[model samples]
Structures are given as C-alpha cells and as structure tokens.
Target: MRGTWLRSAWVMALSVLIVASLATVAAAEVTTIRWLYPGGEQPVSQQTWKSQIERFAKVHPEIKVEVIDVPWDLAHDRIVNMVMAGDGPDLIQMGSRWIPEFAEMGALMPLDQYFGKEKMSLYYPGLVKTVTYKGKLYALPRAYSTQALIYRTDLIKNPPKTWDEVVTISKKIQSEHPGMYGLGIGGANHVSTLSQYFTILYTYGGRVFDEQGRLQLDSPEAVAALKRYVDFYRKDKIVPNPLEYNREQLPELFSAGRIAMFVSGPWGGRALGLPPDNDRIPYASAPVPAGPAGTATELVSDSTGIWAGTRNLKAALTFLDFITSPEEQVQRDLIGGLVPQGPTMATRPEFTKNPFFKTFIDMAPHGVPQPQPALWEPFQEVIVNMVQSATLGMVTPEQAVKQAVQELRAKGLVPAEKK
Candidate 1:
C-alpha cells in the first residue's frame, strides 16, 4: 500500500510540471505594447478605455496592450525624460502643436509607410496637415476641434454675421440685461487666449508666419485684429473683466447667466447639458463673425504616434489602426465631446443632425491651423502676453504688436526683413 501511494504522488508531480511549462510557452507567444495616454484619467474615461482594450484583445489575441494614463500638465515633461533616456512607451498621445517639437527630437517614427494615400485620405486634409512635420507624417489625428459662437437664443434672435454687428449687438444686449455682460473673452495667460486671438487674426488676413515662414505679427492686419479685440473690453465695455477668465471659465460663466455669448468648441454644448437633439438647450451655435478677410476659426487637434525605439512596431501599428477606425473614432467623439475627425464620421446622423455639432462641422472648411514652432511654449507666452498687455491698458495695440515682434526677433524665432 505504501508503494502504491508513492507512485500516485509521482504522477501528480509530473502533471503539475507539464501544465506550468505550457503556461510559460503561451505567455512568450504574446507581444505586449505600452501606450502613454494623456488627459483621460477620470473613472468613466478609464472604464471606457478598458472596455476598448478588451474588445481589441479578443480580435488580436497575440497582442497585449498596457495603457498608462498621465495628466495633461505633466505629460510633456514625462515624455521628454523617458524618450531621452531611451525608455519610452511603444505608443504615445501628442498635441498637434507638439508634433514639430517631437519630430525635431528624432523620437517619433515616420508613419508615411504605414499610412499611404488611401488610408491617409480618411482624415480631414487640414487635420492631416497639422500632424505632418517637414514633409513627413508622424502621427494620426485622434481628436479635433474648431471654435464657434455659442449664444443664448433667448437674448439675441439673430446672431452677428460681421465684426461690426458683433459689437453693436453686444452693446444692445448689455444695455437690455441689467447685470449680465454681453460677451465673454479670454484674456488669461493660457493657451485658449492664443486660440481666441488667432481666430480674429486669421479673420483679418493676419498670418503669424508668412508663406516663407517669416514672422508678421506687426503687420497691418495683425494690428487691426488686436485693436478691435481689445476695443471690446476698453471701448464697447460689452465684455466683462477678461483678465479673470480663460476659455474653460467662459463656458461656466455663460451657463450661470453671467454672459450672453462666448466662443468655444463642441464641448461647450456638453457643458451646458445640450443633448444630441438640442431638445431643451437655450443656446444656439453660429459661425464666428466675418471680418475684412472673412471668417476663420482656430483648428486644434490631438494625434497618436509610435515611439522610434519601440520593439513591437507591428503590434503598435495594429493598435493604431484599430483605434482610428471609423466606428471607434465616432464613439470617441461622442464620449469626449470632440468634433469628428473625418468625413465618414462627420456625415453620421449623430453629428450632421445635431444642431450644435452641425454648426461646427460647417465651420470646418474655414478653419486655420495654429502656427507650428519648435519652441511653441515660449512663442505662445509672447502671444498671450501681447493680448493681456493690450487689454489691460498697458500699451496701445500698435506698440504691443511692435514690442512682441522685437521679442520674437531677439529670440531668433523670426528672420530680419529683407531690405
């Protein structure tokens, strides 16, 4: 009986060894890729992404994806450090403006090979241009937005169609409403301030960089744009203290009935609890007022790229293709309150039929992308300061523009004029 018990124990040990070996072989067959995602850390955002990964896993059982969520404020520095150390993730989310900076660093993979003309044509041409740096495509657009006028329908039956009309209507609105302001403009030292100013600048035919990439911030068109924008606060007095507000804050102020109108992206509707059908929302969206040059809105986008040092290139490309598919893109737009990135998703009933989204979609053709500079942060600082100084009565618009031009020249961001 004792010999029989020993034989049974030996058989059990052999079976355990075989099972462990099989598990190890299975694990080795799968490729794992790391994705550094920024600005979706909330519980709902987290769950949504988790579900997406699970769905992808079922289709590509040979690949395993690990997502790392990082806050927006810290993502840039973290990515720089990791890339410099040669320890970066396989995939990364990038702000469109950062594409030039990253491409210059030689840390991103050129994606033209993976996405030919056929696949590249899936995105808006303007959006695709933003992700291209020095003639090479480095990323695929994942999020896109363009600004528009969001006004209270109860206050103004007809939205302004021209710059003069905007000011005139605003003055009347302010007079009718005792305590509330007519418009909210962002003057804080934030990126939104730059975007707001760009809309006006482009509308007036002002180009920050000429076709040859020379700075023109002090041009006649640019000066006129700034003067008119500052006049809203100083001359017309239809806008509140802009020094206290940024783009994000203006929407809240509008919701609280402190202001009758503001310019924002599609997310503005979501902030005001606007449904897809525009059911009970009191606000309506319209194109930005046209200027001498015509209407132009700042086009902003976020894109995804693969790190140059990634070992799992094939897996990274597979994940990129999966996430950027038409169906996935539509779902992301709905959940994040972003504009559709391509025509396929834009034509969907969810966007084309929705009044608020349709307005932004119609405005996409007139969108102007932000200037791409390798030193974007410092360049943005100069533009923001220019707006703030002029609005706060620190200097005249002409003087402000001249001073900003001098600073840009000193920083070597712009070349001296060809005399």
Candidate 2:
C-alpha cells in the first residue's frame, strides 16, 4: 500500500510539471509582425533585407516578421487611401514631411513614451527628429540618406569650400575640361530632388516663411540666393544644355568625367564607372558648403510608422524596436544611403567608418532644414517651373520669384510676409 501511494504521487507530480511547462511555452509563443515598405529593386529589398529580418527573428524567437513590398510610385496614394479606408498594414513607411500631416490627423501612434530610458540610445539624431513632429514622435526611422557633395575629387583636386570658390572653380574647370560641364543637377523627380536646391536658399539667410508663418521669398537674401542658382545655369553656363537634363542623368555625366561636381544625396558615390570605395577614381563627399548661416545641410528621412487604425499596433511596435536595434543597423541597413532611425544606433562603428558617409554624418545632426509645408508638391512644382522658366530665359529670376509668390498667395498657400 505504501509503494502504491508513492507511485501515484510521482505520477501526479509529473503530470503537473508537464502542464506547467506547456503553459509556459504557450505564454512565450512567437508573435507575427507584418511590415510594409516602399518597394525597391535593389539588393537591399530583394535578398539582403529579408535575410536580415530572418536573422533577427532567429535571435528573437518570440517574433516573426514578414516584409511586404509596395511599389514606390504608388506608395503615397496607397498609404493614404488604405489608412483612410481603415484597412492598412500594421506598419507603413513614411517620409519626414509626412509626419506632421499624418500625426495631426491622429494617423500615427506617438512613440515618445516608448523612447524612454531603456531604448533611447539606438538611433541617429537626424533620424529621430524626422519621426518627432510637433514634439511627439509618431514613427521611427529605419534608414536615411544624408546630403553630401558629389564631386570628381580627382579632377578638382581641391574642390570649392564656398559659393564664390564654387564659381571660380567651375569657370576654370569648364575652360580646361573640354566637352565637360563644371556642375550638373537633378531635373528628374523634382519631388525627390527639389529640396537639394531649396536647402541652399535657407543657408543663404533666406527664409521661405517669416516668423509669423508667411511667405518671405521677396527678401534680399532670398533674391540673392535665387540669382546665385540662376547664375550657375544661365550666367556661368556651367550646367549642361538646359534641354538635356533630369535626375540621375548627372551620374552618367559624372562617371564619364564630363562634369566636375554636383550636389546630391549620398547615393551619388555609386555611379557606374566610379571605382568601388577603396579603388581609385572613387567618389568623395562633404557638407553642402556654407552660405550666410555657415553651411546648413538639409535633413531628409526614411522610417516606418504604425498605419492609422492598425489592428496590430503592439506587434508593429515590436518589429520597429527590433529593426532599429544597433545589431540590425550594421547587419542590415548600414549601406551609404541607408541609415538608422534611432539617434544613437546610427553612430555605431558600422556607420562611422566610410569616409564619404562620415563627412555627411558630421554635417547632418546640426544642419537640419526647416520643415516643409504639408503641400510640398504644389510648392515644388511652382519652384521648378519658376527655375526652368528663368533658366530658359523666359523670365528673369526676379520675375520668377514674383510670379511664384503671387501664385502662392493667390492660392492662399502662403501668408503675407512681415506679419
């Protein structure tokens, strides 16, 4: 009878242990996270990024992330429509300018609460500011492109450090390098490229908006900057035939040794003929040089935000935290144009090493540009036509600025300056 009682007790204990273990396993089961990003054909999108997330999942066995790519061209409309219709992904990729507009509409979850003591030291400053709009962080940047000077360093040997020097160098290079232009610019995809030109206007002590939030394009500093830009294409003749240009076209010209320099994002270094980073004929970069404000560079961003009305907020935030971790930055997103979202994670050794990116990193944290208005597209279109019209001699730079101001005011897009 004693033996029988002992065996029964052992069996009961074993059953309880198994039940407890099973409950523990169930409680710690993995969660599924869905991610949506603007699509890319680059290796970053196709193979590398997927494997990266999978590896992250390996270490974090409690979460499984699935990436769904959306066409870049349709990303804007798709995201807005999906969110408006109340059926979007758990996460959405967003641009810096989109933060304010979306957050104001309650489309994003403020991340400030989550960025407390435990996880604050994992991103770059530029990336952090992008998601923080009106003092609330609505998203977290995963990677970003820093502004840089893309010049044929070998030819210029000593590139210009200021506007006046830029002009002098261009004039000499134009005369010496036959069939080559001194400078070139992006005309394609003005939405993506226009800021490269606009940021310079601000650094010249030109304000697009007055302290009262009114148009201030008529300021003398503004006019001077506009004239300086027009001078490059019109007066200096350093740019290519105004008819044969657009974005990415400069890369071909630059790689062929046909242009001395250009202002572009970090991606410019990878133009085809340019040798790899360690090779000769490789590209180099620096801050977009000083103007009146002493060398300001524009802030640009790429990040993931929770889509409005997502059914899986908790899951999405988990995935965001994982991707923005320092390990993933080096293992996944540390390519030159690709940057981390957290202020601390971006400065890790992986991001600080490349010379071209390092120059950009140095300038980026302090030199953020002014926040563009929600309707940047309309303003962008007006600026392009204005610049092109002036460049093609259809109008004076003064007349173009006047027309731009008039058009904006007529639409009530800009308030009167001097408010």
All candidates' lDDT scores? 0.85, 0.68
RMSD of each: 2.5, 5.5
lDDT of 2 by residue, 1-419 (tens): 99999999999999999999998897668676666777644565656567767777777777777766777767767777877887777887766667666776677877787766466556555456666765677877665665667776666777678877777888888788788888876544356445655667767877676534567776777667777777877788887764466655777777777787877666666655454353545567767767777676666776778876776667777777776667765555544355444556546776687777677667666456444454555666777777677667888878888898787676555533211
Instruction: Record all residue pairs in model 1 with backbone atoms less than 3 Å apart, i.e. clashing.
Output: none
Look at candidate 2 and tell me the lDDT of residue 257.
70
lDDT of 1 at 248: 85
- Candidate with the greatest lDDT versus the true structure: 1
Q: Which lDDT tens digits does candidate 1 get at residues 1-419?
A: 99999999999999999999998999999999998888759664676578778989999999999988998778888888999999998998878888877887888999999999888877888888889877899999988999899888888899999889888898898788788888899989888898888999989999887645578777999999999889989998988888899988887888778898888898887877655334343888999889999988988998999999999999999999998888888888888888998777789999897787899988889988777765677778888889999999999999999999888777665523322
- For model 1, where is the 10-residue window of minimal lDDT? 410-419
Number of the predicted model whose TM-score against the real structure is largest = 1
Candidate 1: where is the Cα deviation over 4 Å? Answer: 1-7, 274-281, 414-419
What's each prediction's TM-score?
Answer: 0.94, 0.82
For residue 77, give model 1's deviation from the true position in Å: 1.0
